[model samples]
Structures are given as structure tokens and as C-alpha cells.
Target: MTDTIEFASYIVERLKQTGVKQVFGVPGDYNLEFLDYIEKDPVLNWVGNANELNAAYAADGYARIKGGLAVLVTTFGVGELSALCGVAGSLSERLPVLHIVGAPSTRMQRSRALLHHTLNTPSSFTAFTDMSKQLSCSMALLNQVSPDTPNGYVDAFDETLRQCLTQCRPGYVELPMDAVRAVVSTRGLNVPLPDSHAAPSLEALRQLTPPGTPSPINKLYKDFGFFEPKPDEVTEHVVKIITRLYEGAQRPIVLVDACAARFGMGPIIRHLVEACGIRFFTTPMGKGILDEHHPLYGGCYAGRNSLQPVRDEVEASDFVLYVGSLKSDFNSGSFSVHIDDAHAVKLHSYTTQVGYAEFPTTDIRHVLPLLVGALEGVKSERPRVLGESLEQKMKQGRVATLVNRPEGTDIVHKWLWPRVGSWFHDNDIIVTETGTSSFGLLPVPLPSHASYNAQVLWGSIGWSVGATLGAALAAEEEPDKRRTVLFVGDGSLQLTVQEIGTMVRRGLHPYLFVLNNDGYEIERQIHGATAQYNNIQMYDHQLLLPFLAGKNPATPFESHVVRTQDELHALLLDDKFNVPDRIRLIEVVMPRGDAPEPLLLQARLTAEANSGH
Candidate 1:
């Protein structure tokens, strides 16, 4: 009896090891049994999202912020399917999340019964599992008939989590409703999960592919590659090559991207910039990793779609040390980056690319430190790459945009984001939606230690609203009270706006900055400038707070709409508004035609690409 526990308790215990403080989900019939365990757990809080999709996104945001495992629970078939798109985003962005799906009972599944959630066919039992398999690096659909290990569910659970960690992406597990109550050995729980598992996940995954087809794993490795250390000599050789190139170039700069943070290598990268005294810039994905006020800091780089000063300086540089770059179209300004393979040295978690040559096994963790040490003493002729510092230029631009504007004038994107930038406190979590909110925030720099959480690569609308909830919850777990903030457009917010209710119920305090430009401003910039498709029905946003926050809550919420410059300026300066206590919503009114410079540039580039020009 001492050696066993309830199946649901076992899973919760596994989660406790990952240091995840909360589990996000929408309770359905299949998952109701599991929810009982989640609700009762003292360590892990159950954050009931408005829907399955938002829960998945919340899980993603939580993992990204917490830098640990994120667990998302859902019911069978329909519930899990609804959450897949959000899970897919996490998978694509290499966020570690375990999608625990409470599935049908073993008896029901094996009997080939027409389940309520099924497609009315016996063969449809495996359909959802099959569909989900494509989205996850590894998955285990456990049942009574499933092959059992010595420890059964415990071993399977550990193995599944191990895959999620090693792959640094999403993984899936299925727990039958009856299996949630199954007795399992306590032996597996006592033994901590290993650094790597003995079981071969790729070999098992290969079986799911077509019989004669080549392994998809190989193709995946070709694309995303793998992260591992190599022989001492290979790493030394790569470091020497980078050091040589750095010494030779008149103007050398570092271009950082999202994977540095994803792989937890930001500290070493930051150390490299400081120790080597190299000027550095960040892609939208890479922002907030380094201190923006650092002397060697350059502006955010996004090919041609960057601030004019940033674009000019980056393009002029003879050498670029690209670290953890994920050059998707949106992140890379519609594939407009001019830095070629010959001029750039890329350091990835998996591999290092020097010129046109690539080393498959030299891990960035091993190589980055050595390169930093090698270049630490070297004297760079040009430490400061740009004529005018990006920070100073931002100040100048702020004056030009906001200084002379009338009190009653509408707040445009140019004036809005910079003002928002100046208002941010250190160590805040800033989440932006895929529309103008994301683009508008790019040109301005964030405060030191601020965490930027934009779904730029995935470009999922309404993502920020759900992500904000997760970020806020994750922040609550931090020793320091890190303020959470969200900037989502009026149109994008409508997609998953119900998440506000979840935020209210949880008593999470996030600053929700809704950019009210009428509709999809980014879409308007892309093609339909004045078309009806770009328009959206307006919401009385000031009432959004009271309606969403339920009656007579523990903490009060503040909501305001600012149509003019003075209104926004006054609200931002208010001490009550700055406190991270109550949830706040600010609907800042702006011009319908106005957009951030980066968005305008990318939209034009996207249109050209679509037109086959």
C-alpha cells in the first residue's frame, strides 16, 4: 500500500517535479475525473480557461515565462482537437509543454462503442490520437490493452516528459478515464527522471509513417536539426574560425533571435556581448534578452522593415554573429534579410554555421563560451557601430511624435508605442497580438529584464489575450512581483476575448492595452485598405472590465478609453494605474489608416511576394 498511489495523484506528482505551479484547462466530461485531482492539489492551481484553445495558449505562455514544463489538460476528441492549433504554435516555437488528454475509458474504446465525441465510427477512435501525433515530437496513448512496463503508467509518464524536455517542444499523453483511477507503483515517482531515456522515441515514431516512405525524422533533423556537444577539437576549431572573422571585420555585430531564450542560453549570450564588447541587435523574437540601455546595444533588426537607423547600420556591417535565428517571414521582414551565409556566422543550439560550412554536433552551449573567451582580450577598432545610438534616436523620435501633439488629438501608433515603452517598468512581461500591437511595439526598446511574449512567428490572432493570462499567473509565482501587460488590437482581441473572464476569476492583474483602430489594421495595410472585410463591429470597451470581472470581487478593476493624447498621457502617469494590483484595461483610440513603420514595410513586402513580383 505504501508503494502505490492513485493514477491521477501520480501524474500530479510528476508535474510537481517540473516546478509548474498551475495547470491550465477546460474541464470536460472525460477530463472531469482528472480535474478533481488538479483542483485538490495544494501546489498546482487549476486555471480554468474560457475554452480549450485559450488553455493551450496559456500553457504555452506559462512555459515560456516559467522556463519549465507546462501541462495542459483536455478531454477526448473535440476538446483536444480545439486545443491543437495552440499546441501546434507551442511545438513550432519549441516551447516545452505536456498536453495531457483525458481520453475515453479502456472498456468503451476497446468495445468499439460509438462515443459521444467520436465521429460515429469504430475506426474513428484513433483518429484524434493520429491527428495529434503529427503535432507532437512524442506521444503515448495509454490504455489497459497497451503494452505495460514494469512500472506501467509511471514509466510512460516519465518517458513522455523526458521526450518533451529533450526535444524542447510539445509532447502528448492520453490517460483513459478509468485509468485515472488505476493503481500504479510509487517506485517510478521516487526515482527522478533521467537526463535522457533509454527508450528510442524516433524508432517508435518511424513506425507511424508510411511503410515504404523515408523517415520524417531525418527530414525534421534536416530542417530544425538536433542539439548536442561534439568532440573538443571540433568546438575549438569553430571557435577559432569565429574569433578570426571577428578580428578581421571592421564592424562586427551580433544578431540574436528567439532560440537563445528557448534553449536557456540567454545568459551566456549576454555574457558574450559584455565580455567581448561587441555591439548587438535583436530580432523581434530576440528582444528583452539583453539590457536595452547597455552601451553596446543596437536597435531591433528586422531586415528592411526595421527602424531606418537599425536597417542602415545592420546592412552596413561586414560581419554578423547570428545566434539562435528562426528567420520566419514575419520575423525576418518577409524574407528580406540581406546577410548571406558567407558574411554571417550562426550559432544555434544544435549546430554552428560558419560561412557556407555547417557543423552538425557542435552545440552553441559549448562553442559560445569559448568564442567569448577567445575574443575577450582582442581590441576592436570600432566598439560602437552606429553614428547615433539607437536609444538616443528613440528619444528624439519620441519628442518629434508626442511633444507637439494637441491634447485632443488622436493617439497614432508612432506616438503610442514609444509612450508605452517609456512607461514600462523593469522585469515586466509584455505580450502583444499578431496585428498592430506586435509591429507597433517592435521599434521601441523594452526596459531591462522585461520579458517579451509575442506570437510573432506563429502570428496567431487573439493569442496575446490568452498568453497574458498565463504570463500573469507565471509572474505571480516569481519572487519579485513582475507586472504583466498585454497589447492586442480591437479585432484580434475579439477572437479569444472571453479569456478576460478567466483572468478576472483568477484575480490576475494584467494591463490590457487594447488598440482601438476599428478592425484588422495589419490586414488593411496588406491588401484591403478600405474594404469592408477590414472593418469590425465596435465594442464599448470601457464596460469590458466591469462585465468580465464578476460582481463584488476581491480586488477591483479599472477600465478607461482614451480618445486623445492628453487622456493617454494622464492615465499612464497615474500612480494608481502603474500599480500591479488590480487588472487594468486601456482602449487607446487611434487613426484607422495609421500603422507602425515595420508593419507597413512588411505588408508591402508580403503583397509583393503574393503578387509574384
Candidate 2:
């Protein structure tokens, strides 16, 4: 018989089983015991962050790239509360994060004794978990133990993790101080955690047909009729409706969004796009979900901000297949996408919509493969070749528009992003902050196998710094050792700049590019042009590395500042800087008011919207 282990050890082993190599968090008195177990584990590493918020962001970022559950360990009350914002972002973006909070001992909780991190009220113990319910898919409070069932806490932990994986959102668990060492039977660890896929029950199959009718299972024919179809049958019918819409339309197009990656549907969607010769486009939130290098890949479609040809093709399409679309204002170019509901078929993570008809419980995972099979040999009258010129136009505008610029000319938004694009290599994960950097990098064509990370819906500034640290760690584990590239405005960088020190301490070498455009440039575009409230204090960008790196760094580091177009162009061509042996930071300065062309158009639309136009 196998020996029982401490509850903390069981939790660590379970996390490792879920593919979590690192646990990101801040150590506290409440969590110290749990941290010891995590650190001593052979398979798991403890990544100590400067703060709990950064730890949460790192965990979320790690989950985004690793494609499995990411674990974050924080202490009770203060620590868990600090990490709530990050957890909320993960929930909004559909990323799976397991947030484990170390709480006071069971005795302390039952006695209602005041604790240092507690709110000093009778309800203090349960306050965090109650608040967490709003941001997490599941929550487990393990303060009370069942006398009859010693292993009851394990069931709660298992269910919380299961919900996190199945929902692709955050989950919470509060482990009391004493329970950390509570021994539990290791029997549960013998069997692997169940996946999201559930087999159809025999009872469900019987419900699909009327009494005395032939089994619907046997009727795989095209004309199979149902007397009373179950949920699965209705989902299949919706899929067929979408398939027919695509097959019948002359000028059909596929639009992808961020949920494709969040729900692990990128490969399936790519297969559908490639197998059917249809023009493909991505919303700003969906950027990098599809390979921009694909011959049939068109430019990004952000409503009015899209290129003329891309806008024309998408808006004028006879039918549109929008997969995992999160039509937020910024993503849809201030809600300006002109596709009519009658002509579009939308697919979400858990729901599918054929025009105005909505089908709940119809997962994109089940429908995509069927859609791909139905449209394998189907060809649209609008050839995929139409996308080539549009792609070329995007590239030409970047390359030709800035060529032969005079010396001493100030760097503008137009020249900066495209210039940065030339430096991107394959297997690079590009993370952008929520301001100008987000909108600026939209048109830059990502290389094959590259990913563009942005918090478009969350719109949280300073998320990229911690996220980059997490992504770099995740990438280091990959076979090819993908590079993590970050683009953040000076204002956003100030919020989570301490993570740079964490990256240095961890020996991660992400290429950090800070856009030093004075302050809050994206916000300035949306509302305030020259308002003092929109501005922030400037810092010596070059000094950031030296200060963050400190003395006797583990790895080599490089930092540079470029103010003019010629200097920026020359830096991109420099091999030594391009192929750095360590962490590299490039601060590209641009005019205060200048922003990306698309961003400027979006700003105008946003301004008009606010004025009741």
C-alpha cells in the first residue's frame, strides 16, 4: 500500500500533475509552511514575486502560453486581496489560474480571533473567499474539517481545479495553516484528473428519439430526423446551419478572436482556414491567433480603423464566420464593424450563434471539427489571392513610408511600430501594454509561430511586465526556447517595473522595448489631448537597467535610448543589439501627441461617441 502524505505535499503533486512547473506568489507567515513544501518538491519551483499582484499576473501569463493550469500561492486577506485584480483579468480573458490562499489555522478561524492580515471583524475569515466568488469559477474554503471524512478537503480542491480547467478561468482554495501538514490518503493522486470532455450517457441517447422510433445513433444519414432532440443534437443542427451558410455564400470570410487561443482552438481554426480557401482576418483582440504569414491571411479588421481593402472585404462579405469573437469597443474599432446579423455566424467558447438564433451549451470545440469536415473541399468565389495585395500594402506602408527620412527627424508612431516589426523573429511572443503599444502593434505582421499578447478587453496597464516574466519562464521550457518580447509605454512600465528585477533574479532574458512617448499617450488620444492629468513624470530610461540589474548581475544586460528616426533605423540593423546574449531594453522616444494611424481614427470615433454624435 502507498504511504499517505501531508496535505501540502498532495496539493503540490496535484499541481505538478496539472503541468504546473512553477508556483508564483509572495511568501507570508500564513503561507510559509506551504511554501516550504513547494520549494522542497523535486518537480516544482517557487517563483517569489515582489508582490502578490505581480505574482497573480505572472501566473496568468504563464497559463496563457503553457496551455494548462497555472498555480499562484498567496497568503490570507491582504495577499489574496492584492491579487484579486489580476485574477479578475484572467477570468475576463478566459485563462486558467489556480489561486491558493494560505489562511489562518482552523482553531483561529473557529474562535474568530483577530489576525494580522484579517480585517479585524467577526466575518474577516470568509470575506476574501466571498469576494473571490465574483472573480473565480470555483472556491474551496478548507478551514473546517469533516470528522467522518478526513480526505474531504481533497475533494474540494479537486473540484476547484476541475472547474478552472473546464471553464478556462481562475479557481480559489483557502488552506488553513494547520491543514498544511494534515496527512491524507494518496489514493486520489493515483487516478489522473478528469478532462473537460464528457462522454454522452446512454440515457441522453435514448432521449434524442421518440418512443418506438429507430435509434438516432444508428441514423448517421443526412436525413436523420429527431422527434425530441437533446442538447447535443441541437448543437449539431446549429453547426450544420453554420456550415451551410459558409458553403452557400460566394464571398465568405473567417474572422478570429482571442478566445481561440484561450480555449485551445487555434490549431483547429487554422486547419479550417487552410483546408477551405477563404480569406481570413483577425480582430485586434485576435491578432496573432492566425499566422499572419499565411498567403490567404488578410490585415486586421478593427471596424473603421482597418485598411480600406480589409474593411471593404469584411463589411461587404455575403457571409462572415466570426470565431470566438470578443467584440469590445477597442477591439471592434469603437463598435464600428458594419457586418449585419443576418449575414454573420458567430461562435463563442460555450455558445454558437447562427445569425440571431442562439444555441447554449454548444461548445466551439465540438463544432469546429464538424465545420472543418463539412467545408473541406469548399471554395469561395472570392479567391484567397485577394489577400496577398492587402498584406503587401500593409508591409509596404511600413517599409516605404519611412524610407530615406532626413536625419534628426523625431520618431513618430508610424515609424516606430513597423520598425520594431522588422526585429521580430519566429517563435517570438510579443506582449503589448494596454495603451498606444496595444493599438500601435496591431498592423505589424507577426512571423510564423509568433504570438501577440494584449489585454484588450481588460485594458489593464502594467500587466505586460509581470506577464513577460511569466511568459519568458514558460518559453524557457519550450523545445525551441521562444523569446519573450514586450512593448509598453513609459507610463504603464512604472506600475509593474519591479518585475524587471524579478526577471533579472530569475535569469530570464526577455527583450523589453519601452515606448517613452512622455505619458499615457493612448489615454490622451481617447479623451485628454494636453491635459495635465494625462501626463506623468519622466524617468531616465537608460538608468532603469542599471538600477534594476543592481551590482553583480547573474546575466549580461543591455540598454539603449533612441530619439530620432535615423538612430532607430540604425539600431534595428545592428547585429549585436538584435542578437543579445542577455536581457535587452530599447527606449524609443516619440512625439507626445503622435499615435498610430488606426489609433488616431479610433480616437476620433471615440471622441464623437462620447459627445453623443
Candidate 3:
């Protein structure tokens, strides 16, 4: 006789099997039953978020730090709609995030009655799922028990999850209100889960191999890894072109990009870089991809927008080998990075380019390991490394000088970033907002074992606040308990600031650096510097901790306001302030128009592009 279990238990069990330990979302009438199973499971922890959007952003951040998949739950219609942008960010950023929506019962849907969260139309029931289809790699609506899927919806859930992991992108599934209580065969629980894929051996993931160790995504990002390559687009052809370029060129360098950080290519890239002993550089999106302390790391390269030494080094190279490059306007310095197809070879998750030739062959996951042997022998013959560390130059007078500063001088972008870099602690998880913080953090040198998170490609304002909560939870769970720090502007913080309360409720201690610039500074650079449209109402940021946490909170918290350069310096140098024992919010006031150099450069290029130049 086959054993049986509720559908909700099966979903919870499958999630547990996939290595996910926590579920994030706000409880709604539709999802309350399912949340029960999550809470009851000893292994699964339910993180009740302030809102659905914040939940999705939290899920995205969690996926990034865990280096794998994450789970998000939501109620149908209103809840799911609120989360669309966050889920869209996951899709655009290529994060393996599974979004499960608790939908209305089949009976209620067939009746077509206007529900609280639904529109007054017959199509309202399916409209949300249809809208979500465009945002996810795969999706499934589980409402039946078919022979092919013996345990009702487990097989379909498993398949959709497999597709999400295979692509390392967002996925979707809808569970009806009644279906949560549907009886399914417990025997299916023993069958492998949505977590394991490709390997015939279920034990391999834990024993030796890992998941989503795919290639660095293509920096060009034209195909987004969906196109079928021609017969000539083979891996062998790419290997041939790369080997030839390396052997013939006097100066060839390795460049890593956004895909390198998301697709688990860090170790492989590092291994190849160390074995070859050649200098390497990263695109802005590719920061934290390798050990910055590595002598071979030649700071960030962004066309004319780069530092003088960095620009000189890359522009002077005879050949370039790019790994998972992303050349968006912001990432590429407004299309200023120019490279001859004949002198460069680009690698992607599912494609490879030999100069102008594109290979739609096996993805980077399969091709990258092979190159470890093919190119490890092609080290540079001459020393081409920059004379001094780019970060040191940025801090030690190249950008700003610390000496003889007026005590009341307000913090500026050029002067602030380098100082922040020096304050970074080992194993810190740095999260930067899409505005100034994102571009500004690029010049700062990260400490050993530190990881950087930025929504560079997506450029979503207010994303970092909620992301910090998820990243902090993930970091807290790690063996070393890495400290999570967030750099967000006061303007951007207004959008998703409610998550701050969520972080406090969860007892997570993250460093919140609120850059108070009075308004949307990034927007000011792009279009309206002094336009009233860019202005935002100001709030007393120093009171955020106490107000958000409520009275007599168990979580330790502190807040500070810095108006002068001297005060800022004193705070950063405080030993007690630097410790991660409590959640600290430092409100640093700055001039409204002050912005990072890269952001300014990008704004100028964008303006020219807009004017049809």
C-alpha cells in the first residue's frame, strides 16, 4: 500500500531536499495553510517579510550569497503583482529563484466570482500567471493527480525547478488554496527532489560535484544564451582561436565580468588566473569575482571611464580574453570600450566567441574546465602588471588627500569611497544600491574573503535595503558568520525601507550606510541636476533604528549622524563602532549634486545617445 501525505507537506519536503533552509514572504489568507507546513518543518524557517516586493528582493539576495537557489512565497494577484519587479530583477540578473504563489481554490476560480485580490473579469484567475510567464524561465500550476505525476504535483514542481536551475534564472509555480490540503502519495517523497538534476547519481551533489557551476554569462548579452549556434560554432573552434591569440600576442590579458560572479565561475577563473600568472581585470559588474589582493588583479576596466593606469593597461593590450562579459551602457562606460574582434575571444555560459566568430556549442560550464589544461601553459612572457595597486592609488592622493582637510568639509564621492575601502573588514558581505553606492564601491579595494553585491545590470532603486536582510541572514548562517554591510542613498532607501523592520525583527545585525544627498542624485546626473522632479522629502534617518524596531527591542541597535569630514573619520576609526555586535545605521550627509565619476560618465553618454548623436 502506498503511504499518503498532504500536498503542502510534499512541497515543504521537496524544498528541504533542495538545500533550502528558509522561506520568505508575508502570510496571506490564501497562503496561510501552506505556511503552516513550512513552520512545522523542523528544518525550514519561515521569514515573514514586511511586504511581497521586499520578500522577492530578499529571496534574490539570499540566492546570490548562498551560491544556489532560493524560495519565495506569495499570495495570488495583489501579492504576486507587487513582487513582479523583484522577480524580474532575478530573471534579468540570472538568479535561481523559485517563486511560489498561493492561488485561489479551483472551485472559486471556476465560479469566476470577483475576489478581493482579483479583477472583475473571467480571465482574472489566469491573468496573473500569464503575466508572470514572461518573467520566469519555467512555471507550473498544480491542481490535479495524473499518472505521470504519481504524487499529484511533485513531478511538475520537480521539472520546473530543474529548468530554473539549468538556466539559473527565476521560476514560478502556483498552488491553489484547496490543493494545499490535497492528499498525495508519500512514496513520492522518497523519489529524488526538485533540487537534484543531470546527475544520474543523487549523492554526487554532496559528495564531489555542485550545481549551477555554469559558465560566466556572455558580457555582450546579445543572445542571453537562447540562440542555436551554427555548425561551425563548436567548442574546438573557440579553443583554437584562443590558443592562437595567446601564442601570437605579446600582451594578452584576462577580463572577467558579471556572469563570472553569478554562475559559480569564480574558482575556475581564479585557478586559471593563478596557474597562468597573467594579470587580470574585471568589469564593474564583475567586482568581487576574484581575490582583489591577488597581485595580478589590475583594477576595473571601463573604457575612458577607468582610472588612468587601468585605462592605459587595457587599451594598450594586444589581445583580450573576456570571461562572461556584460557590456551594457553602464558596465561598458557608455559603449566607450572598443575592441577589435580579431584580437579578442569572449566566453559565455552557452556560447563562445573567437574574435568575430560565435559558437553556439556546449555552455561555459562544459567548455571552461577544458581550457584549464589548454591555456594554463600560456603565461605572459613579460611583466605587464600596474606599478602600484589601483586601490592604493585611489586612496593615497590620486583621487583625494586625507591631510589638512577642514573639520567641517562635507564628504564627496572621490574622497569618500577610498576611505570606505580601507574600513572594509575581512569576510564582509558588501551590498551596494544601484545609484551612487554601486558605481562608487568599484574603486574601493575589498578585504580578503569579502564578497560584493550590486544590481548593476538591473539598476533598480531601493533594491539594496531588502537585499541586505536576505544577504545578512545567509551570511549569519555561514560558519564564520560574515558581517553584512549595505551602502544605500537616502533617496533610494525610501522605497523599500520597511524591510529594515524585518531585519530588526529577525535579529540580524547589518551595517546600514545611508548617504544623505537630499534627493535622487543618480537621476540628477542622468537628466535633471537641479530639476524639482528629482527632489524627495527628507526624513530623520538617525531615528530609523528605534522607530522601526519598536520600543525596548531585544535586538541591539544604534544610529549616528555625520555632517562633517572629521566626524565621519572619527566614526569609521572607532573600534567599538566597527564591531558587528549590533545593527548600526550611519547617516552621512553629503551635497545633493555630488556623484561618482562613472555615473557622471554614463549620464553624459546616455544623454548623447538620447539626442540621436
Best of the candidates, TM-score: 2
List model 3 lDDT by residue over 206-231, tens digit each: 12212344332232244565653332
- What is the clash count for each candidate, in the order shown? 0, 0, 2
After best superposition, candidate 3 residue 281: deviation in angstroms? 0.8
> Tens-digit lDDT track for model 1 on 491-591?
98899999998898888889999989989999999998889988999999988888887786656798888988878989999997888888888888898
| Candidate 2 C-alpha lDDT tens digits along 255-329 | 998777777777888888777777889999898987887887877999998877788878988888888888988
Cα lDDT for residue 271, candidate 1: 85
Native-to-model Cα distance after best TM-score fit, residue 343 in candidate 2, in Å: 2.5
The global C-alpha lDDT for each of the candidates, from Candidate 1 onward, is: 0.81, 0.81, 0.80
TM-score of each: 0.91, 0.92, 0.90
Q: Any runs in candidate 1 off by more than 4 Å, and if so which?
A: 144-148, 190-233, 377-388, 396-408
